[model samples]
Target: MDTLTLQSTIRMNNGVEIPRFGLGTFQSKAGEETYNAVRWALEMGYRHIDTAALYGNEEDVGRAIADSGIPREEIFLVTKVWNDDQGYESTLRALEASLRHLKTDYVDLYLIHWPVKGLRHETWKAMVEIYKQGKARAVGVSNYTIRHLEELLSNTELVPAANQIEFSPFLYRKALLEYCVQHGIVVEAYSPLARAQKLEDPRLTAMAQKYGKTPAQIALRWALQHDLVVIPKSVRKERILENASIFDFELSAEDMAEMDTWNEDYWTISESYNPECSPRWE
Candidate 1:
């Protein structure tokens, strides 16, 4: 297997380099908590950070980045437009707000937080314009299924550079992963640790013992070995550091296939987020 490290990156369709592992800031509060987490991650050599406007932590994330003394170009930053902010003009304004909150001129990648029912196409058009204006190095969507991807591909000119989704050994959406791969879209795993849902499963625990690593490491290694980007979120310093320690070991192919059998199509996000069953357009 190829060696992996903190600096390992995968090139997107737009030719932008994105780290294979990143710090995810979901549900992280918008002040010192988030600021400290991001700061520590950066100080610990993390080069990529993912946040979304809906997380309400962009300001803190920006503060952490600014305080880290890391050069802006050295970090790959990402943020998304929220559902209500999913129209052409609105998305343009939303990006401006995100940029201001992030205290940056542009984001490495800007994504649609969800494929909001009717406005997705228009929102995507705005995203393309944002890309053309150099405000977003690359554009993408989150929680998008193959059906949603098809819609975007059939209507938009630029293919999404990434798709952020709930993924783990247990909730693995293999077909979606395959679709994204076939379309040259990088699949980023959120809830990559199953939000701790299966972290203590006997299978994971057994694997952990075999590898002499924590169950969390085993879970993360599973994602990394599949060549998918994994961002396991945590605000605690030790946990933050622990999340990045998956690069040192390799999971065997047999183990990989065994982990693959754990999938149960579980949905970790709130019920309202089901792409096929979103609430009525607002």
Candidate 2:
């Protein structure tokens, strides 16, 4: 078994260390299913896990973390406040709820799940407060477009430690990537495999053939090459292990150029992010 090496870790703005590769528990079912997924992921040597309140699987994730017997400090647990929970008071309560559900006193990273209409600034304020109070080690956002990030910078004191977005070769975000690099925000690729659509992509396959690795691994390597934290998810044990096997080979610059050119108007998620929202999270 190839252990995920520490040579790949990325240091965030807040001095919080994050593993470049991790398991993403988005939309994983609740109860036993999520618990099993988290346990399996940890058993397979995943040290970071990303989840959100809207997914409703925090308790299951927490249970697995607890049972894994991995000390709380060893795991990089991340959760977010949902759209409805965007106000200062609501975000505070929401963080508490996520903590209780995850069975932890604090999470490594807490994020705003989305930038809904009208409430992102206030939510950011609340997040800063939480960070200031030492409730969360770092604060960040997900699905925040560049416009949203610019507005956040204009309004808030804390620069986000990360921005987990849907990034793959097919949806390459060159400008946003540069912006994040300039701003000190680590760009995290949530759908690095493009929801598994890129598994059979010819460009990726050709590179995989050349490198003798899977297309999934090629996709991850591409993201990592750009210094993005890539979270490729899987419930199957073989896949869980396979996703972490990108450390052995490096994608060549010519192949990286070809893979990078694969981007042509593709995005997996809908529901455009508007930073305005009604004050409540349910």
Candidate 3:
């Protein structure tokens, strides 16, 4: 297979194209920090920027995009509506706020940030309307488990253009990935580095030594080779550059198979992070 580059794109079900690699602004602060990080990522050749209303960094993200001198069309800007904003009229209002904060007339992609139980399908209905109005080039979801996706597919008219999930070799959701692929939905891997928690695993360490690359790069390459769009988050200049370097290398089938064995369905537990509460996994 040919080596993938930073500029490689995958077309969504809506015919909107998204970059295969992107910089994620999750915990990035909404000021000079977020602004500088985004500016640096764009300067370093990143064409995709993923942020959300929950991140509280939309204003800075928008500022960086405006100052970058790159035309808005050239960048695939993605943002999401938070769980609290997940109802019919509320979602429409949220998208307008996101666009206002993003300082753009339209967003490349808009997502329902999480599957908030009774609100999931209803939120999707509103998103579909937003798509119809061309406010969002494409609409999708994040943190949706397979059961949640099934419920959504059964009710919604338009299939989601993509599904963003927490994916890495350690937390690999193979079955969910397969299901999305079968249904013509692009699977985007957020937190693709596993929050840098398992980067020092013996296997990843060995691969890093053998390949002369960092363990994080090995992890990102694993996600990309699985045909998943990867949005690895980092605010540091060097780490951002390191994450972007994975495109030059391709993992072999044998190596990928070995990486598959690393899966433990690991979940990052935090006092504030509740997947069941927010995403409602089955």
Candidate 4:
């Protein structure tokens, strides 16, 4: 298989280069916890960092980025707007708020956190406007299903450049991934290590043993081998460094195939698209 690096990038539908490995700020609460994790990740060579308005850590993330001294252009900054901010006006205001909190004038990628029922079109319109205004280099969505993708494709002139979803070996989205490949949208795995749940999986553990790496590394390698972007979060400095070290080793095709056959039930997080989820569009 081809190799990957912290410097490697996946092109978006809009033709922007996004780092293959990103630092996830999900659940990274505000204050020193998030500020420290982001600082450590950047110090350890992570150029891509993902955050959302709902994470409530944008200010902390902004602090880390400001202090890291890494050139803003060298790092790929991506953040999303939550469902509550799903209207054209709300999205516009939210983007400005995110920018203020992140302490950056432009984000590398701005995404619609989820596809809401009545206001997704309006939300998307605002996102396209953000992109045109140079506030966001590219715009996309998260937790969007194929059905949701089709809606945007058929109804709008602007196409999403990427889709952020909970993807890992336990939740291999083969069908949606195939569709994305055919449609020019890049699929980014948010909970790439299943939020570190696969730290004890037999298949992952065995592969880690064979490679003398951590189970997390094996899982991340599985995603990288498929050419998908993987954002794994960790507050521990060592773990942050370990996750970025995935580029040094390659998982064999045989092992990759075996891991693929492990199972296909990995969406532990309930998304807005879940029919069971009562609409939370505010």
Candidate 5:
């Protein structure tokens, strides 16, 4: 197995380098909570931070980055355009709003938060424009299924550089991961630890003991071994430090295979909201 590190990165189809491990600021609140989280993550050597317009914490994220004094060029900042903001003109405007909130001239990565059926194609057009103009180092999609990706591919010449999804051993989505890999789209796992819902499962706990790591670490290591980018969310200082400690060990192939079997289509996000089953993507 290849060695990995806290600062390791994966190159996108467009040749932009994205850190393999990142901090996900999904439900992290605005103000002090979100601010401290990003600050702590950066202090601990994290170079990537994922947020979205819908997260309502972009200002705080940007504030933390600015205060870190780590040189903006060193951090891979990412934000998304929300559902209501899906359209050619609106999407373009959304990026501007995000840039303003993020207090940066441009984002390292900008993504379509969700595939809003009729509007997603036009949104991609805006994403292409954003890339061409250099406002985003790379453009990608989040919560996109194979059908959604195929439709965008059929219509546009620009392939997304990454695809963010609620992925973990419990919700493996093997076919989706394989398709992303085959097409050179990096798969980024958002809820890599399954939102702590399955952290106590005997199987996972046993594996954790075997590796002398926490269940969260085992889950994150599993994702890393599969070559997927992981952005496990946490606001606490200890958890932020703990999440980045997966670099010291690698899971054995047999254990990896066993974890793969643990997939039951479990999702930290509700199934109704899952891109595969969501009517919003139809």
Candidate 6:
């Protein structure tokens, strides 16, 4: 963990290398806000950028990358197929639309944004096809639970290269993380800081003081130390810089265990929107 830098990457199952830390553009607005945020992140040495068709910022993200003057292959770009576009044919069409918006012929990684009930299997089939055709270097899923993963594995010969999930000290998903690891699927953590909902907690703040870092850094560092790829979102230049300045320190083993106790199954997304709680997942 001490040797990790902003440039460090984890190799996916398909031999694609993904930067372990990245910028998340979930709620980042579609225009200049998303564009500048991505530009700042790239300037700060972030090579991976996570966006989606649902985010409505792929063009902004693409423009920022193109304008950054960085070679396209140097940046590990990721985008997702939204729930509404989950069928096999529509999934293929969705990636094409996303590519047109991102202004790229291929994505470093492509994901099914959600496990849209009854459509996820077909969606996975399309994802496999995309991967085979080189449209995506690797294909995976997001917001998937253990059951969903089990169902996917049981039905498909190809294992997902990664699984993006909402993970943090405040929403520790130990079982899910372990399950992914056992299956050789990398876990990418979104909302790694729990959307700042618990950043002000006394325990987290105290740890931040102990490490001379911000609570957000502590949370992101924890995720990194756990070997999870973490993408924390921020639009402000200062915050973007702050989020990337997490590699200089390491949390003690005792403190890591203490933070693990902070989990309450908390979620920033409402119950109706939380994928874990959706009846469709059953």
Q: What Cα-based lDDT does every candidate model obtain?
A: 0.92, 0.85, 0.90, 0.88, 0.94, 0.94
Query: Per-residue lDDT tens digits of candidate 5, residues 62-179?
Result: 9999999999999999999999999999999999999999999999999999999889999999999999999999999999999999988889899999999989999999999999
Candidate 5's error at 137, in angstroms?
Answer: 0.3
Candidate 5 accuracy as TM-score = 0.99
lDDT of 6 by residue, 97-190 (tens): 9999999999999999988889999999999999999999999999999989999999999999999999999889999999999999999999
Error of 5 at 149 (Å): 0.7
Report the CA-based lDDT of candidate 4 relative to the real structure: 0.88
**Which stretches of candidate 3 lie above 4 Å from their native place?**
269-282
TM-score of 3: 0.96
TM-score quality measure for candidate 6: 0.98
Per-candidate TM-scores read: 0.97, 0.93, 0.96, 0.95, 0.99, 0.98
**Lowest summed lDDT window (length 10), candidate 5:** 271-280
lDDT score at residue 191, model 6, on the 0-100 scale: 93
lDDT of 1 by residue, 1-282 (tens): 769998799999999999999999998887999999999999998999999989999999999999999999999999999998999999999999999999999999999998887899999999999999999999999989898898789988899999998999988888999999999999999999888878879999999999999999999999988889989899999999999988888999899999999888777777676664666422
Alpha-carbon RMSD of each model: 1.4, 3.6, 1.7, 2.0, 0.7, 0.9
lDDT of 4 by residue, 1-282 (tens): 456678799878778999999999888779999999999988888999999999999999989999999988988999999989889999999999999999999999999998888999999999999999999999999888888898899988888999998789998888888988899899898788898876898878888999999999888889988889999988788889988888888887888898888766666776644522436432
Off by over 4 Å in 6: none
User: Please, what are the lDDT tens digits per residue for candidate 2 over residues 6-69?
Assistant: 2357899988899888888876888887888789888877889999999899999999999999
**Candidate 4, residue 20: lDDT:** 90
For residues 1-282, could you state the per-residue lDDT of candidate 3 as single tens digits? 766899889888878889999999999987998999999999999999999999999999999999999999999999999989989999999999999999999999999998886777778999999999999999999887777788889997899999998889998889999999988899999888889999988999999888999999999999989989999989999999999998777788999999999998776655235453443443
Query: In candidate 1, which residue ranges exceed 4 Å CA deviation?
Result: 276-282
